[model samples]
Target: AGVSQEFDLSQCVREPIHLLGGVQSYGALVAARRGDAVVDTVSRNAAGVLGRAARDLLGRPVTELIGQEQWDRARESAEAVDVDVDAGADPAATDSGAVARQDGPASSGVLPMTLEGVDGPRLFDVTVHRTGDLLVLEFEPRAEGGPFVFQNFYPRVRRALQKLQGASDVTECCAAAVREIRALTGYDRVVAYRFDGRDGPGQVIAEDRSEGREPWLDLWFPATDIPPQARRLYARNWIRVIGDVDDRTAGLVPERRADTGEPLDLSASVLRTVSGYHLEYLRNIGVASSMSVSLLHEGELWGLIACHGDEPRRLSPEVRAACEFFGIALSLQLAAVAGREEADELARSRRSLASVLARLTSGASDDWMRPGSGLVELLDADGAVLLRGTETVEAGAPLPEALPGLLANLARRGAVGEVWSSDRLPEVLGLEPEEAEAQGVPAGLLLLPFNRDGDLLAWWRHERPAPREWAADPSRPVRTGPGGERLTPRGSAAVYRATVRGRSAAWSPAQRVVAAELWREVSGLLTRQVVALEARNT
Candidate 1:
């Protein structure tokens, strides 16, 4: 491993990647303060790209390089780049230099610009953005003084978007998006990866790869592959591209910002250099170039349109923008599909709840506790128990003799109801593997307290029978760092099959919501019954 001797796990999370003080070598960077609009920072290659040394470029008025008209346009456009998918410009409005040789609003100030270059005149696709008071510009040379005709790519992408919108489910949406991106970008591999949760591991839900490329579809990747810092950055930006991981990085002229005393934050820069650790990670997996289009939901990173190439490949500017737009559309579609599914599930649960509540006043006081009350099935629980003083109402399954004592202990620990939940009780009680089974109690359960007499309603779930498929050895995630000692999570494409014998299936959001709704309705009915009985006695 080429890891530094000082490397440690803590450093991995704490690495200030935004302050790397460099940009990718595929382009050059120039930045100036908004106050005086004088050049304050430039990438080392600024002279080669802008035909001026970084030293000479510094302290010069920005108007000396770019016209005042262009400066104002760039500023307005940078702010106008909305993260909202609906706010994106139509493909017809894309910059012609990168699209159809006609000028339009560059997705990211991507208009063609001419400047004296080290090799004479250079036509470049310029990108502009801001980080605090500094306005930054990146200059990437145009291949053959032009780009792949967006005119041709536009029709294909239009169809792709229509296909994506027509997808009936999340799996369908992700798979369709993956194929479109692969076809559009010509990457050797493309994957639509979904996170288990905001902070959990990721699974490759859909993948499209070139012939003979190792299949990564359905593989699991550890969350550690993306550190906390990297995740935060991904959530903020819509796109990132690595033209060549092996290319030398261009260092900034001044290492730190004079005002903030920190390396200028390039969190939004299109050409910001990547982390060394990440670069090494890519090398470990033999990836030469890569790109990622973030799939966001409600401002959080839900997943990514991840692409990779075995050789150094830089996509034309418009292609990158189109992929970004596709990601935005995909995110919205995926969320909508999931939202509709959840809405349908919730509607069914509500219908069940309505039927149960309708029988409340018509049936006997004890009738609501029967197996037909729909309470047992509302949360997918195998059984239900309502303990009132010394008496107990059981449905679907018989209660253990020690039920009262267990409920009392849980109430004292505040482990009942919202404080604690199903699938966590066994761990919280520190029950041994054999003890959980021998106790004849549900391995998982949910509960709601009724009153001070230790009265409550509880639902139980017994142990499940299936084993889980893990991407790696879950217990031993430690691995050797490439060339540093790193606490590598899951990187290798391998599988680990493991079973947890003592636990039942984890409760889902649908079950929780349904249970809560049922509790509210039933508790209200019980209160009304208490008042009616008192009136009759009086």
Candidate 2:
């Protein structure tokens, strides 16, 4: 048999990312300083408004770049804030403070300065941070439209929050969020892409788009689309923009850090250049410009608010700040909606289980593991089997002959949880897919152990073929390239079918909760039954 050399593009999700190099193509001008002197700089031509190329600014005193008065104020502000950046700490931990304070009040700590522009002196809003031995300065132009633009911006954010507050569920809130974000940024399309779990695939749950465009609603993208390192950058930065995909990126004058001899840490940089692979991926998807705002829940990346444009577009600093604010507001609303939904579902399941427990305690001759019983209904499984000592009672789908040995081995290896479940039993049990299918075993299995001997209750579900619609055929994920093989984004936007095998319907959160509650109740019942038998013998 010939082993195919075709590259699995999905493996790109595990590829290592170098985050701290290259200057971003965006407009923000960046320069590194040590004490009161500039060591290196990277500026766009548009930054000529600041009056010098990156090379000319190098080896110059900071006082010459910005007036002496402005430089002094920046130093004073840094000392007043007493910001600390631990070099050895995780980048994520060190960068959180900057992301958290990005949306603070305009006057809170902004260092206002006047730099010599090509025309004359122009005002700029500068933010300073200490990264290891370097003082990184990021400069943004003052709004030409003035402070009123910001005053109006805050009200719009308030209105978006009010709309979210009125939403009754997670879906409704996500829909409202995409709409509001599109309206605020004027993007051609806005989508709320949520991850299934950590390192899981993402799905476009809600979308708002311009007329005459195909919608990406409900479309799923593989986890490899955004690699782990990219996800880490999203968590640290919270907001990123590609002003124009075709624009060339500028490079830092000195590529390596002066002290560490490693790449400059750009984790907190607003002007960090994106990876070439990511840029190509966007081009394949037909996006000209893009912006992403991270939606973090409980310090973990839950999803993203993605904005795309058909034409090159750039958001002003103020506008980008507003988008970030909207993302924060939306994250809070999503958490509220999910918490409420989970609570409501758990409550319903608890009520149902309580009724079953009452009947069981009243000497009712009910087999809880049988079809239509509370345990079966609670877990939402098609069938269940109860194994007590040497006796076995099966209901719904027939129990497989090999299940007992498999369960015993799993328990011995500590591979099974207190209440373990899997939609694809073949993968979890290390069985060959073909052999699993041939054995006539159900695709789904849930085990609840009742004793150290591996005696337990088992729930089973027959295989159910679920057809997934993808933007392109996922099996052929990569294309042959001039340089051996390289990962490429799915080129076709047309819907493609993929039939999922070796799996059954997933167990819902509500079902899991009910299973845990039923386990406790059943264990108590078994204990009581054993006590009664001993009393009779005595």
Best by lDDT: 1
Runs of candidate 1 exceeding 4 Å displacement: 1-8, 84-108, 117-119, 145-152, 387-394, 397-458, 463-471, 481-493, 499-510, 533-538
Error of 1 at 319 (Å): 0.8
TM-score (C-alpha, index-matched) for candidate 1: 0.83
lDDT of each: 0.74, 0.68
State each candidate's clash count.
5, 0
Question: What TM-score, to 2 decimals, does candidate 2 have?
Answer: 0.82
Can you give the lDDT of residue 535 in candidate 1? 96
Q: Name model 2 segments beyond 4 Å from true.
A: 1-11, 14-20, 26-49, 52-64, 67-112, 117-119, 127-134, 147-149, 359-366, 412-417, 430-435, 481-493, 528-538
lDDT per residue (tens digit) for residues 1-538 in model 1: 3343544455666677777889988789989876677998999997766777888889898877877877777777766764422222123423211111112222245656777555777777888866656778888888763643668568888999999988999989999999999989899989988886666667888999999776777777666677666766676667899999998999998998777686766766788899887887677677899999988887778888889899999978888888877887888898899789888888888888777777766768667678778767777777878777787788776775445568866655432344245574555578864676687656777777766567677777787744646666655444555544544433335577765565777776666777776666667777897899899999
